[model samples]
Target: MTLKKPDPSTLDLSDVDWQVSTFESGGGGNCIRFGRKGEWILISDSHNPDGPPLVFTKKELEAAILGAKDGQFDHLAGLG
Candidate 1:
């Protein structure tokens, strides 16, 4: 069965439980924070907890995680 992507716009982000990766703690650097609401995954900068976030479907988030594990997005780090 195909899963429908949930609309982040319809979500109440305030009610979601946001979490930071364990690697982010005491790393002396800012990193991304993520939260999940149903099938949607929301991402935001840890430094800006109140800032706007980018939302993605669970499948899309999974794909991104896999890509990161494989170093497929290593080049992005240099773009900063």
Candidate 2:
């Protein structure tokens, strides 16, 4: 079954439990918080909890994660 992507402006994020990695807990507020709601993955700035979040589909998020793990994004983070 395919899940419909939600409209970020219409989605209610009040009930979502956003979390940040422990490694970024002390990053001086320069990290992002992410949460999952159904098939949507939400990402928001840790410095602005009440702001609108960037939304992504489960497959999209998974691809990004896999790319990161493969060092595909390391250059963007200046790690490569």
Candidate 3:
């Protein structure tokens, strides 16, 4: 099957509110995902663009986001 590319518009990824993130396929270290519903996402806060992006199940990600909204989860991200 052909892999479907993510549409930026549909994802609504952007730098604002310091919450909700989506992973970018680039960077070396310091990758973290943070934020709330409607503002959900993943991202890599690094340089070099070598490290692989982290992965999270839709359910797990949604759970984490809920945890974040309630101030329960930390923002340290990693690949799964």
The candidate scoring highest on lDDT is: 2
lDDT of 3 by residue, 7-78 (tens): 434453343343323555454434453433242343433442233333334566778669877766453444
Model 1, runs deviating above 4 Å: 1-10, 24-29, 78-80
Clashes of each: 0, 0, 8
Q: Model 2, 11-77: lDDT tens per residue?
A: 8888899888677555686688899877789999888887889999878989989999999999887
lDDT by residue for model 1 over 1-80, one digit each (tens)?
86765555666787888887777455665788889877678998888877778888778889999998888888887632
By lDDT, the candidates rank as 2, 1, 3
Top-scoring candidate (TM-score): 2
Whole-model lDDT values for every prediction = 0.79, 0.84, 0.44
Q: What is the lDDT of residue 39 in candidate 1?
A: 69
Q: Could you estimate the TM-score for every candidate?
A: 0.71, 0.83, 0.36
lDDT of 3 at 58: 57
* C-alpha lDDT (0 to 100) for residue 19 of candidate 1: 82
